[model samples]
Each structure stands twice: as C-alpha cells, then as structure tokens.
Target: MSKLERNEILLLFDVDGTLTFPRTVIKPEFEEFFYSKVQPRATIGIVGGSDLEKMFEQLNGKKILEKFDFIFPENGLVQIEAGKEVGKQSIQEHLGEKTLQRFINYVLKYLSELELPIKRGTFLEFRNGMMNICPIGRQCTREERNMFAEYDNQHGVRKAMINALTREFADVDLTYSIGGQISFDVFPHGWDKTYCLRHIEKFHNFEEIHFFGDKTEPGGNDYEIFVDPRTIEHKVETPDDTRRILTELLGL
Candidate 1:
C-alpha cells in the first residue's frame, strides 16, 4: 500500500456492500463519514455497477448525488454530472449490432427450447447505449439469483458460455463479471475499474484518491478499482472500519 497524503486523494467508492450494506441500503456510519468528514476535504465519486435508477435509490436520490460533483454509474458506462446524465459507453461497441443481435437471439432461442432445472436470469437488458445480459433469471430473489453463480462453479456454465462465444466469434470478445447474485456484467474485454478510473480521473485532478469497496477479491467486482496505485482501499466489514479509514486518512 502507499502511505500517501490524505488531502491529495480523489476517492472513489463502490456502493453495494461497500458504502451501503449488502442486499440493502443501511449504512449510517459510512453516510456520516462520507457527508461530514470526507466529502468536504476531497472530491468523491461513486463508481458502481448498478443501474441508474437503482444507483439513485441506493444513494437516497439526487440529494446525496448532489454532494459529489460527478458519478460513474452503471459500472462506469454512464457518466453523470450534477444529477444529469452526460455520457455513456456500451460494451456492444466492440460488436456490430447485427452480430450481437444474432448471438443474443441464439441464446434466447436455446434458453426457450431447452429446459434446465436451474433457470436463467435476464438474457438482455438494454439501457442507454449499453446492453447487459444475465445468463440467469432477472428480478428474482437473492436465493433464486444465487443459483446462477453456483451454476458457474458446478456446471461451469458461465466459463463455458464465454469460451463458447469467444470460440464461435473470433472477432468479438466476451467476458463475465460477478455482479451481485444473478448478474453477469458483460462488457468489453478491458472494461474494468482501471478503465473507469481513467475516465473519471481525467476530469478531476485531486490531491489524494481512496477507494472503499467490498468485492475486491480476485474474480470479484472490485478487482479493478481497488488496487489502483494512487488509491487507498477501505475494506468493507464494519461501519467502524469505513469511518476509521476515512478519519485516519483525513486526520480527523
């Protein structure tokens, strides 16, 4: 880790399980530390994989968002400014529409024709310029959703899916990310926290930057952003840790 100066940080935090409690939003100490201690000293931005609506809901809407000057929402696809969306990047940019459509249609066809004891979630979720696909069920309970993740390990479905697609489509690249229980965040081969931070960092030149998140483990969602050389990682375990990390960094 880098024992860097606190004020010279451009802090970025992942919301689910990091700032907000996992599965639900109930983190008071983090909220207090964010709004009271950290928000004033350094520029803060929430870099999460959640959709726009869910992002606002988790953050208590525009009021909380207004605290930060900018947001890297939708897993770094959509850039929001002052509560208004300003830009977006779609994973499909790497794939032609016709080609992507063909693959998506084929997946849907196979899913409909074949019967699996374990069900799947959303196959395609299109929003803005981006298109997301969850090989399992969408909007299902956490238990129902978890089946998909476990399926990846037991049946090797997730890995197999990526391998099959990559083999079939040599010109296209397909990758999978564990987003929550029932989600596979398919983005460009290089769409990750580093890339996301590159985009966010260009706009704001901060003196210090820190990252607070949960899924930093390998193959977990926070892998990309957590290990940034300029970032201070605050692990999500107890609210006290979040507060302590922030206070210690800020010298509060």
Candidate 2:
C-alpha cells in the first residue's frame, strides 16, 4: 500500500459495505459509529451508490452531514461540494442541471418502460451519477440476490451484459464499472468511482487518493485506478481491512 502524511490526508469513504458492516442493514448501528469517527474530521466525504436524497434519508444522525464537506452522490455525476447541493446557485459551477436532467430523465424513462417492481434496493444505485442497473431492478429476496453474485463470477468485468447495456446506450456516452453483486454502473467516460476521487483531488489538491471496493477482476471498476498511484487507488476487501491498511501506511 502507498503512504500518506496523516496531516494531509483527506478521508473519503464509500458507504454500503465499506464504512458500514452487515452491508445489507443500513441501520442505526453503522451510523452511530460513523458519527463517532467522522464528527471531528475537517476534510471528509461520503461516496456511495446513492442519490443525494437517498443518502440523506439513510443518514442516521444530523452530525454526519454537519461534519463532512462533500457527498459525491450519484457516482461522479453529481456532487454536494463543501456543504452545498449540486444545483442551487452556489454549487452550479462544476456541474450543469441540463445535463443532469437529460441523464436522469433518460434513466427514468428507460426504467419505467421496463416497468419492474420498484422497491427498496430494487431501484437504481448511483452517486455523483455513477449509476448501477440492479439485475432485479429493485430490492430482492435472498435467492434473487444470488443471481448477482453469480453474475459476477460468470459475466462480470467490462464484457458483462451490463457493459453491453452501456454500449447499447452508447449515445449516452456511458461506460461500465462492475460494482457489488449483480450491480453495474453507467456513467460518463471519465466519471466512475475512481474519477470521483480524481475529481475531488483536482478540486482539493491531494497528493493521492486511495479507493476500496469488494469487486476487482478483469472488468472490475477499480482495476484501472488500483494500478495507478498518482491520482487513484483501489483496495480489495472489507472496510475494517481498509482501515487497518490506512493505519499502518499513513499512520492514521
């Protein structure tokens, strides 16, 4: 692993399985610990496969938002920079509403046409516009969830069907990033999870940005970032292991 000076480090954590354990249960326990570690941090953010509204809804305490400077929600397609939402006047400089609306509408229409049952976990997974098309289209049962796990083992990476979907919608300027389970992301050419880190780096001036994810293989999203040390990184495994690594490498 690479090292960072503690004083200069900016902690950006991916939610879901990384920061929170019991990955399926987005509950109070995880939020409680999240608040405990994050409240005092000056520079931090939450980068997850969720929209801003969904992220806020899942938040366990007010303190989580009170402390973090940004929420790179919807992948890198949206950003809540320095405590400001993506739209509104102040934060409008980096992203545009027209583009977002087009993308959002396209997705909405696309999914509506499919007319799948939309439920918790059954909806799209996105952050900063890093979008994931869940196989079941929403939340599912234990048995149904296995399909995604199976998908990864058999058809994941850049060549998977999800990747083909991006190609199918090639007009949208999309790309694929294999995420957890059967989830796969569709976002702009340079704006995947790794790009979110790089975008943050460009704006914030970081020496390096370290990433972590449960998925990494031939077509894994973080694979490219993991190989590069200058702007991005991809850690393979649980958040606790990630924490252990940061503790030793950066003396955090």
Candidate 3:
C-alpha cells in the first residue's frame, strides 16, 4: 500500500495487545521503531482501558511512556504528562456511587455463581472511568491464563458475562464489552473509548486521526472508535502485527 500522505495526523493506539503482548513489555524492535520512526512523523497517543500503572508495565519504562504526546488511561477518563495527572473525569461520579457499587456487587455475585474450575485473585479492577471484570482473575500466571483462555474459547465465558450484565443492567443505562481476551469492561453508557475523541479534539488540532487496535469486533472495547466516522481506523492482530503496520504506515 502507498504510504499515507504525510500531514498532521494523530496516531492513537490501544496498549494491551496492539502495542505489546497483554501484560507484557513492548518488543525492543517495536520500541526502537516508535522512537526512531513513528514519533517523529506524527503526533501519538495511547487510549486504553488499562490504568496508567498497567500501561507502564507494557511500555516497560517511564522513558518509553514519555514518547507519546498523550496517554489516555482508564479509557480516556484521564490524561497524564510527565508523571503528573493533568486532567481527569470519573464515570462513577456520573453513575452515582451507590449505583456503581451495586453493579460491582452484582458482578461479583455473578462470577461466584459460575463456579468455574479455576479462580485467581483480583477478579475485578476499577479504574477512573471503567472497570475490568475478569472471570479468571487478573493475577493469573501465563500458564493459568492460557488454561482459562482455552476454557473461555470453548465456553464463551466472557460473552456470557457480557450478556448477563447487559440484561441485568438493562434499566441502568450502561455499556459492556469483552476487553482483550479474558475480561469485560463495564462503564456508563457512552463512556466507551470513543470518549477520547472529545478530549483530543478539544485540546489539539489535526487534519486526520488514525486508530489501531486488536479488538474491533462488535462487542469489543475498540469497536466504538473502529466504527466512528471521525477517525480512520486500522485493525491489527498482535504486537508483531502492530510493528509491521506502523512500519508500513510510517514508511519506516
């Protein structure tokens, strides 16, 4: 494909699988490409459901994190700079504390009801604007993660969770989607990742913006932006795929 025309473009990425392996550091070559190629050509930002701490785990270091012009953590609920928080918005603030707490309680109960074969610690994680619910828990080791992943593939546990929550919270006006491979992200209606567009437009100017993500299916976290008309979107499969896409997109 011909290189995208050079211009003031905003290249936004999803961190977990798009930028690096889930819960892992960026590949060395991918890191080199970001610094030597991508960053110099276009404004870059990371808009992800993971909190800043987890995002840093994937980036590997503060120096690597600093390369992006913006980092929209917790699904664009906050923007950070130089290890300082510059802006923040909380979905629980809008949803009401009582309601959010109730939702959490319901999720916990639902997971217990499933009575799956394996369970790890820290099943649900609350972030600024969203919460990640994992049936198998977030603290699973790589081997355990793979085991649950196989079971989930066959049982569609994540999808079942999504459906259960959607129906249970139908009257509450919320959104739910499978995030990455193991969990579902639940937030107030309209708080999907596309929420970043409003903040980005308000703070910066660009002729065109591009988004790359691994999960762009109908019920995936990146689906909202993938379908949005305001931004051009690219779908990638893995970190290596991301590197190849960026290399070609940036003409590296």
Candidate 4:
C-alpha cells in the first residue's frame, strides 16, 4: 500500500505486555519486524499507562517518539504526535492537595498493614495523571515480579486492593486499573486508555482503529479502549501473540 493509503488505518498498541515484556526493552528481532514490516502497512501508535520516560526505556529509548506516528503516554494524559508533545494534563492540579493527601495517606496506611509474600520500596509511584500502587513494590527484580504475579493470580491480591480502594473512595471520581504483573493504577474516571481516542480523532479520520493489548478484561488497564466502539480490539496474552495477530490480520 502507498504511504497515504496505509496512513488511513491506525494500529494502536499497548506497550508493556502488548509490545514488550513488562519492564523490559523490546526484542531486537521483533523491533526489526515491527518497524520494517509492520510500519509499512499501517499508521502505528502506542498508548501506555507508563509515563513517557518509562515507555521510552521499554520501547526504544528516546528515539521511540520519532519511530511511532503517535505516542500516548500516561494513558494519553500526555499526548505526543510526530515526536512533539501536543497536549498534557496533571492529576495533582485536578485533585486538590487536601484530597490527594487524604488518598495517599490512606493508601500508605493500607499497605503498611497488609502482609505479602515479600515487600520492597517505592510502593507508590506518582505520575502526571495517576498513581501506580504496587503491593510488593515496583523495585522488585524480574524473578520477584513473576513470583508475585503467580501468587496474585491465585490470591487476587490486586483485585482485593482495588475493591477496597473503590469502597473507601466511593465519592471520589477515581478509576482503579490493574496493569502489568505487579501494580494497579489510580486516575480520574475518564483517564484510562480510551482517553487516547480523543487525541487520535483530532489528527485524522482513520478508516479503522485497531488496538492490541494484553490487559483487556474488566478493571484491567486496557478494558476501556478494548471495549470501546471506536476500536477494533485484539486481546493478546503476550508480545508474541500481538505479533502473530498483527501478521494474520494485516497480511504483513
């Protein structure tokens, strides 16, 4: 297809599990295939819950901005197009200091009281549009992360925490989403992955918008956009699944 023809269809992907293993850099071979084979077929973009710096570290460092047509970091609260930031939002500004402090204090107290298989530091991470809450902590090693994932799968630890948060902050307009293996995110009601759709719509009238993500189930980070009417959702279990689906769907 010609460049213009290809640009008419936008292929949006999630970063962590959809494009790369969580908290790791992209594989060299997959990166080659994605840029050479996949990029030639459609206008590609990435919408990740991570901040831009983390996305860059996992995707391809700072050069990632130039490689993708659109980059929606922090669930599109920070929008970058053509390697330039076009829009941005702040959660601290939206939720006043009093409310933010109350939420933070409650979370810290909850974490301190809860027991886990193992715990580490940096349990709560503040971001541009959300806070990432980690039960075992984000500083865990890869083996620790995988172990926690397995344990949480059986115990539903993250789910339980999210439920508690929902109940405690019932009056607050906050959304809790489980993403990756270790943590969940807390943001304003509409600041999920679907938030990127608005920014994408402003740029072009694409014939189709395809979103590929691993965490597409209810309460997962990808749930909103995956189920949205504006997107053709492909739920993948890993980066390899994402590649296979892309090749089969687009004939790449």
Q: Over the stretch 1-252, how does candidate 2's per-residue lDDT look in tens digits?
A: 344443345666666556654235445554554455433432566776556665665564444556677677655456677677653111123345665566556655654554322323555654434556665554676566665466546644324455446555666565676655656666666665565665665667765455655554555555554464553454646656655654565434
- TM-score list, all predictions: 0.79, 0.65, 0.93, 0.96
- Give a tens-digit lDDT track for model 1, residues 128-228: 43445566657666776566567666876655555565666666665556656555566666676566666666766665667888777765677777776
Checking candidate 4 for backbone clashes, the offending pairs are: none
lDDT per residue for candidate 3 within 97-212, as digits (tens), equals 89888898998898888877799889998887888899999888888888888899899999888887888888897888777667788888788888888887887777889899
* Candidate 3 segments whose C-alpha is farther than 4 A from its true place: 1-7, 81-84
- Kindly list the per-residue Cα lDDT of model 4 for residues 16-69, writing each as its tens digit: 888998889999999998999988888899999988889878987888878899
- Return the lDDT, model 4, position 179: 93
Give RMSD (Å) of candidate 3 vs. truth. 2.1
Better of 2 and 3 by TM-score: 3
lDDT of 1 at 129: 36
Most accurate candidate by lDDT: 4
Q: Which structure among the candidates has the greatest TM-score?
A: 4
Model 4 weakest 10-residue run by lDDT: 1-10
The predicted structure with the larger lDDT, 2 or 4, is: 4
